[model samples]
Target: MTSRAAQEEGVQFGLADTGNSIPVGLVTGIAAAALAAGAALVWWMRRRRTTRG
Candidate 1:
């Protein structure tokens, strides 16, 4: 049963007509790249330390 206020306001709780898929995809891609870069930097630093020691 829907509330009277909801019925009057006509609020839609569903998918957007024009989705924000592109921005979401870009944000996820950038995050993955940042994580990968961080991992690579750590590996490089560890390798350098071992070689120096």
Candidate 2:
């Protein structure tokens, strides 16, 4: 009985850890995508202005 409880607790902890990892991964991915998009927008604006001028 105690063994089963311990096993259950371990599984719960593992699942929690996995769940935490997913959010961190998602946040990092989002930040990277935002940075890339911002850089692209800046580049496009600069190119357009230079071409016009």
Candidate 3:
């Protein structure tokens, strides 16, 4: 019984790890795009405010 439980636990742990495996390149690209978009938005807002004021 103990051996069976250990085997099942190991299988579950492996599946969990694999489920979280994401491509690093994809993650980095998304982060870079979001950061660039945020910066552009801030710059636009500040420029608009300055022009109005």
After superposition on all C-alphas, the RMSD of every candidate to the true structure, in Å, is 4.2, 6.6, 3.3
Models 1 onward score TM values of 0.58, 0.58, 0.66
Worst 10 residues of 3 by lDDT: 11-20
* Candidate 2 lowest-lDDT run of ten: 11-20
Best by TM-score: 3
Model 3, span 26-48: residue lDDT tens: 98999999999999999999999
* Candidate 2 clashes between residue pairs 3 or more apart in a chain or in different chains: none
Pairs that collide in candidate 1 are: none
* Backbone atom clashes (below 3 Å) for every candidate: 0, 0, 0
Show where candidate 3 strays beyond 4 Å.
1-4, 8-15, 18-20
Residue 12 shift from truth in candidate 2, angstroms: 22
> Best candidate per lDDT, number?
1
Ranking by TM-score: 3, 1, 2
